[model samples]
Target: MSESGSSNWAIEATDLYRRYGTLEVLKGVSIRLQRGKMVAIVGKSGSGKSTLLHILGTLDTPDTGTVSVCDVPILNLSSTALSSLRSKHLGFVFQFHHLLPEFTALENIAMPSLITGKSKREAFNRANDILGYLQLSDRASHKPNQLSGGEQQRVAIGRALMNEPDIILADEPSGNLDTETSIQVHQLLRRITTEMGKSLIIVTHNNDLAALSDEIYEMKDGMLFRSEG
Candidate 1:
């Protein structure tokens, strides 16, 4: 599908393949994630789980096949267009919180909108709104170091949501958290899918975390298959 057409799925990949010189990473992995669903992918290191995530997020390109996000075929878009699409329609979270150390949580969360040329007032308003939803309104003025690990991660999630993206791509979002914190994050992700109606694809190693998703896949030798059956 392209920008002019409609798609039932939020993200779709067809016969995806990737390689780093002689080492093939993805071997025709294809996946379809419906709107408002959460998907979790798990696999050993070097099994191409992150690679697939990068491609789907449009941070990297695949050697073959096509990927569509929000029904927009992005494989051939110009870098500027791709960047614009990503800013408007996608959000990403990594294992690390990646919040700016010097900025207050509000400023860090407001960054994406500011980068997109939104007014400071507008950006902060949206940031404040999401911070409330994330239960971090009280932490808005705290710096990254001032927040606890779980709080920081929630701020990062708040930042990802500041732009009101349709899809969230998370790579090991709760990897560094304690078990209780990890469970909280997992519940938050699932709540986001149901309540906010945003789709999410998370790459994680925790089977219990994966169990919370609407669908689960595990990468093995660069191929992705359903883990449920």
Candidate 2:
């Protein structure tokens, strides 16, 4: 399957395992996510959900496993190749907004494009388009500190979308927001998959929010189990 490109899967993983010292975090976990769908992973704080997400996002390596993103095998790629692949195909959102303090929301959103050598005019043009899409056109000139928590997260989401990634992996994306704001973020995430046709996998603890996903999984004892109704 590693060499096959005909499959419609956005991400496919098999026999994923990871460890730290004597502790095993992931135990032979595997998953396949389709395009334009959303999957939610729910687990306790110490569970391996975040570790699995990091591995899937190529931010961390597994002790043993194979991962293919957009049908490209990832395990054996060189660091430079991996970084390039990650930047081109994957987007990430974390609990904290992680926006740069000095840059305006527009600049932060344009940073990824700039790093990839896009001209400022091209980058900012796309950034403005994204700001409009995110309904934050007025906040583009505001810095992270000036925006509300939800707005800051929306800026981070805009930054993620700037690269036009195939899949989005979010780790507690709404973890720090109030209930209403979290609900808005959750709805926006759902929209990303449904309206924008991007695959989404989110690691979150909120069961109510998890219920909104197309698929749900639970992590426990370093193992992943599909949740059933």
Candidate 3:
């Protein structure tokens, strides 16, 4: 399957395992996510759901396994190569938003493109497009401290999308928002998947958000299993 070289599957993990000293977090787990679909992962706090997401996102390496994104085998890549691959193909959103407090929303969104060697003008233009898509064009000049929680997260989403990645890995993206804000963020995610044709792997405890996904998987005892439809 690896040599066949197809982009039909955005992410594929085979027999994944992870350990931190004596503690094993993932137990021979495997999952395949198709391109242009939203897959939600849900589980208890210590059920290794976040760990699996990290592995899939290439933020961490598995002790024994293989992860392929866009048909490229991640385990074989050097750290620098992996980082380059991630920047070019994957986007990430976390519960904390992780925006730089001193930078404007537009600057924050443009950082990734700039880091990838794009000129400041080119990055900011792309950032402006994403911010406009997220309906935050008016707030582009505002710093993180000046925006509300929902707006900050929207900026984070814009930052993640600024590079036009093939996949987005979001960990509890709306976890800090109020109920109404959460719903708005969920709707935005759905729109992105549907309109932008990007794949999404969201690790969320919110059942409402999970229900909007194309498929849902549950993590338990360090193993991932599909939920019954």
Candidate 4:
């Protein structure tokens, strides 16, 4: 869409359109996300930022146009194939830390690997590695209700990263946290992108977090515009 070379892109969407009955949410939106870079999408409510995220994350399909990840078109994949692809390549975080209430933090983080057919032992090992990276090793046995808000969010991020996904999609990852916690979460996200070389695409309304990204784009009226350096 921007005349960018396709080789550099981890996710690409072209002429994407979406509709909810009489309301058209996305109108010819296109984006090119480069590998190992963090891009932030910001907009007011009802601007279609979340819709774009769902499409890119393979959770939903566009009504028209194409969406691809690492040059693989996902729009037409079988449900099983899409599920496998999402499990192996894409990670997602939401505003709410959706950890299973009955599971410990470690178990929660290990769920993705388990769902992907890894042995329980193997999954827990990988989960341990990510929890340690996020400085949550001490809280491994704690359930979601037993951990602090920041710790729970960290666990959620750990779960998303458990499978070594190529891209991470976060929608208002710190929306429920206080200002200080949100700042810490933002820094953690930046560190992950920089140190792990993981591509991150985040949809958020917080300017501070957006400013920390490698690129920032604004969504308005179903269109995107470059917002800042």
Candidate 5:
């Protein structure tokens, strides 16, 4: 791990660049996310919103630039170290719940912890706690197919929180829900940032949800700029 920087920022990425074959996707994209705040990244489809999120979450590598999560610079870490850092400090939620069809909500939520070597007893205890916190305690035994759209997304969010990560990176988290349900999920995400003290970065096209964030950025033509509040 690189030497730690300011603890105040949950993520700090600078001068990022990425390309596929000859297609340049990110052009000097940069962002700094403070702790306990919600940030919204909004743009048209294929504007590189998800690409930036992936780099921040350590799910993808930038062609050039630096990324630091919770003060530790990650660009130079070994794969094993990077994986550990990503698992311990970052959580991800996508447009789809991506829940395992065979697993109950509780089991799905516990999987992350279990993967990190937590015993089933310990993982399930934490999973149950998160389920209660998400107000989905009664749905713990339900498989993804058995839950409503909003419920499944809530379960996904619970799974994200199971590791007690410092930051949550959500890509179009409410994109698949109806407006009413989307608003609820948006509000729930905001609550998680405020109440659980987890910094959140969400990529969305929803203007209403963007308005609820502490900061908003617009991605256009592979560049990012802060939107006027």
Candidate 6:
């Protein structure tokens, strides 16, 4: 484990770099995410903020850097191993809900646990618990199309929690919602982090959400700048 980050830190990225063709995207980006804390990254479009989030979530890799999740170095892990590690230790929420159109909210939320080899009963039990916590118990049986936008997003969040991941990586999670709903989601995410002892890394353009985070960073010119506000 790196001395700079404690054992409880959910994510640690050191000097991360990435390039595409001739375009250099990330430039020596480093970040730390402690469990039960929230961090936000903001930047204009094409500023590489989303790229950094993807690397942190392990959906993409850095060309030169080290990324650790739960103290496990991930660079050399096989695809299968990385899949298993992600299922067990990380969660992701994006702007779109990405739910199966045919599945009920409960079933959708239960999918991750089921994929990780949990029994159907165990998966539903965990899913139901998260739904209740998110105050979506009444909509459990409803399909995605039957729910409102906010409800759909909440179901997506429940799915992310299915395997009890230690860290959540969100990319504009509230961007599609109205202002009131976005604020509600922002507060809800903070409460969830505190209550579940999970860390959050969100890439957003919304200043309101950024303002609510414990630490905020702005990405510009392929570098990170910590924000005082």
Every candidate's lDDT: 0.91, 0.92, 0.91, 0.90, 0.92, 0.89
For each of the candidates, give the backbone clash count. 0, 0, 0, 0, 0, 0
Residue 209 error for model 1, in Å?
Answer: 0.6
Off by over 4 Å in 2: 1-5
| Candidate 1 Cα errors over 4 Å, as ranges | 1-5
lDDT value for candidate 3? 0.91
Write the residue-wise lDDT of candidate 2 on 8-117 in tens digits. 89899999989999999999999999888999999999999999999889899898989998888997899999999999889999999899999999999999999999
Winner on lDDT between 5 and 6 is 5
lDDT tens per residue, model 6, 1-229: 1236558778989999999999998989989887789999999999998899999888999999999988889999999999888988889999998999999999999998777677999889889999999999999999999999989999999999888888889899998999999888888888888877788988889987889899999999888989886
Q: Cα miss at 109, model 2 (Å)?
A: 0.6
- Name the candidate, 1 or 5, with the larger lDDT value: 5
lDDT of 5 at 225: 87
Query: Given candidate 2, what's the lDDT at residue 20?
Result: 97
* lDDT (tens digit, per residue) of candidate 3 on 1-229: 2125566899999999998888988999999989889999999998898889999999998999999988889987899999888987899999999999999999999999888788999899989999899999999899999999999999999999988898999999999999899889888998999998889999888887788899999998889989963
2 versus 4: better lDDT goes to: 2
The 10-residue segment of model 2 with minimum total lDDT is 1-10
Give the deviation of candidate 2 from the true structure as CA RMSD: 2.2
lDDT of 5 by residue, 1-229 (tens): 1125557899999999999889999999989999999999999998899889999999999999999998889978999999999898888999998999999999999999988888999999999999999999999999999999999999999999988898999999999999999998999999999998899999999888888899999999999989985
Candidate 2 pairs with clashing backbones: none
Lowest summed lDDT over 10 consecutive residues: which window, candidate 3? 1-10
Q: Between which residue pairs do clashes occur in model 4?
A: none
TM, every model: 0.96, 0.96, 0.96, 0.95, 0.96, 0.95
